[model samples]
Target: MNGGVLRVKHHLVGGFSTVTLCPKVTDHVREEIKAFLLNKANAKAALQMQQPAFDYDEEVEEPRPSQPNLKKRKGPMDKFVAPTPPDVLKGRKDRKDIFGVCDKEERDNACRAIAKWFYDAAIPFNAANYDSFKEALELVGRYGSGFKPPSMYELRVPFLIKEVEEVENQLVEHKTEWAAKGCSIMSDGWRDSVVQKDIINFLVNSPKGSVFIKSVDVSEAVKDANLLFSMLDRMVDEVGEANVVQVVTDNASNYVKAGKFISV
Candidate 1:
């Protein structure tokens, strides 16, 4: 009966239990095994949750809108207004008044009136030629209607002569001063109206500005070196060699020779 009871007890124990532990096994070992099994099960569940499922169809993208054009439109008749001519805006009555009276017409009378106005106003007649005078006349006509103009030649010649004389007088006065102090002289010849060749002497003072046409000596043939040299010599004599510091002239052979002679 004891043997039979022992056998039954052993059989029951073996059938109910999976492992058999000896008395040498610790409690910590059992706890470590439980923790390892729990961690493995949690890791498998997290991996399954993180995985993404794939779809086979292509993605549809949205279209971008086009930009609008911003160009400026030009209108017709943008360049049609004509500019006014200078002479018309200035109120020039006649071509002669604007230019000066060349012919002995009504314009000539107008030019004379303009000259008289200038004279009365004490405006210096420095206008170089009739052309310039005509411009002045036109200006005067624009200003006043009562002016009685003179013949263009008549109005112009006297004014020019007066101006020339005044300039010549100033030149002469300066020349005299240049002579008092030692000065140099320069000269050249050129043709004038009526085809007369005139010798123009220029006086240069180191202390003052130079003077031209202070004295004019006319010659029948200005191209003649001997005549020009003779004229220069006479000028040098008048000024005196002691007062005449130097003589400067163009590169003409005659001028070179004259300069050498004068230096001596």
Candidate 2:
């Protein structure tokens, strides 16, 4: 045999015989062994391919990692572009500047006059504070007539009171005239500093040629049914009951009661 070697061995334990073949086997034997091995390996591989793959259900897939939330950074100009303070505060500062140089006497006089103007005009004390008084003085100085010397005070209380009273009297007269021609009345309650709660009464009418709104304030106690009825009675006394048409009011229980009482 060309480059072929054969060996025989006997196992002592099991009494088995073994034969080993080397690369130098005879050509015919080598070919036959090779063919047999090739066929056997191919058959084993094909069987394995035809069989179902074993899957390990115990294998677990991991969840994807969460990403960090990133906020957008503000630009450099954000601070500078912030909103300024309100105009009301700026207006107060400006008024304080105007009243800054006044003497104590002039300032006191101004305050008193301003306070009276507010009282007569029904402006609240809190609203007519120092700054507001100064602003009012400035407004009067700009718009009012007849300029007097510093000794007389630029915007006098007496002058404002007189003007306010005159206007009030004119309004009252006009309202009374409308009432005389027969008008509907509307009344509601409001609060004031001096009077915690007062009734604000008004009149409305549209005749063949006249339409008007007239108003007045009554004491808090007078907001009751008797008082409201009495007020209407007084109007009826003046204008006659036949001329009175209707009374309108808000949805307050008291007002509803008053309306029923009036209707009777």
Number of clashes recorded per candidate: 7, 3
| Candidate 2 C-alpha lDDT tens digits along 1-264 | 222221121111111123223435465654454444434434543454457343333211111111112122334553323221222223544666644656446657867876787789997667745685566556444322343433444347766778879867876665676566756655555667775655465555534333334445675354667766776666555544666677777677767777788888
Model 2: lowest-lDDT 10 consecutive positions? 59-68
Local distance difference test, each candidate: 0.53, 0.50
lDDT for 128 (candidate 1): 30
Q: For every candidate structure, what is the RMSD over all alpha carbons to the true structure, in angstroms?
A: 46.0, 41.6
TM-scores, all candidates, are 0.35, 0.32
Best by TM-score: 1
Clashing pairs in 2: 3-24, 4-24, 4-25
